[model samples]
Target: MTDSQGQTPDTRRDFERFYAASVKRLVTVVYAVTGDLGEAEDAVQEAYARAWPRWEQLVAEGDPTPWVRTVALRLAVSSWRRTRNRVRAHFRHGPPPDLPGLAPDHVALVAALRHLNPEQRRAVVLHHLLDLPVEEVARQTGSTSTAVRSRLMRARRVLSAHLTDSPDTPTAGAGRPATAAQPRQEVLPHE
Candidate 1:
């Protein structure tokens, strides 16, 4: 009845079977309630870990799911509350100040970068400033290398047009740093 450590083999096997059959479905239900895959996964895994030490009792008392589900859902609610509070605290700091620099042109370049969409800005910074390859950048951003390359190309055209001191720069961006919210067409000339 007992294994090397005096734990019953039947109890361990039964718990393993129950876990294999239920974990994915449990996570799906928890994700529906939590609306975040990562959070749901964390909560459900923690619940299962907690249940392991109590497996014999849980299994003998009928289905162990209700116990695990209740614990996981409660943890999800706690996680949501913590996240909401952190967001509120961050917004209280107000918007960040504009990027600073010694040279006006450098400042202007940094400002122009702000106008790019978040994905494009990341592609430029990671590739050009950090000198990372396109494949590495794509890996960091969870995108394919081809998509990252395209982003870098468009970003370069946009940045090159924005960074120049020529007449195009003065008229195109109006001597102001770009914000991420600006439309790309506003900065790019129509072909």
Candidate 2:
């Protein structure tokens, strides 16, 4: 069956083509957004699954890849937010233990990212790390373009401030318990 766009209705063949053509790129985008390879992979898979039935609608509208990517990323973000909330709840109840294999640099980066509010981090990662256009990022993030720009600016400032602080040089509260070592593991996006 085909849609009004003259394209074949979504079928196994269409799904296979979409997956083959876009999986890698989508995985990379998911990884950049979520910072967790396993989660990103799962999210992408889920997104593709969800898109399969609506393939005709998606294909008729435009590039289904972006739609799938956005869905995957939104799912990942929702998962991340839920996990973060649980962790925060746990920490509030008790002292959190140190994360294993965490290095100072990684710790610093994570800390810096954490320092920024979630919106800022999302904007920064989408715009800078993933190199997405502001409009696209806004679409993916469900924010107005102007809001995305503002978030990107704020996130950049926060990241810059955190990165600029010399690791070797002591800043106020440098040795405080709040400081944690970075994770040593190199998080590579799944191929």
* Model 1 local distance difference test score: 0.67
CA displacement after TM-score superposition, residue 42 of candidate 2 (Å): 1.6
Encode model 1's per-residue lDDT on 60-163: one tens digit a residue: 89889767866776686678668966534533552235422335554455456645665786677667755679888787667999999999888877776666
In model 1, the runs with Cα more than 4 Å from the true position are 1-6, 85-191
lDDT of 2 by residue, 1-191 (tens): 76554446446677798799889878766655555556779999999889977777888898887788778978888888879866456434432236456567654555566556667777877787678899988887789999999988777666666665455645533432233434467899999
TM-score of each: 0.42, 0.62
lDDT of 1 at 186: 53
> How far is 136's C-alpha from truth in model 2 (Å)?
3.2
lDDT of 2 at 84: 87
Error of 2 at 39 (Å): 1.8
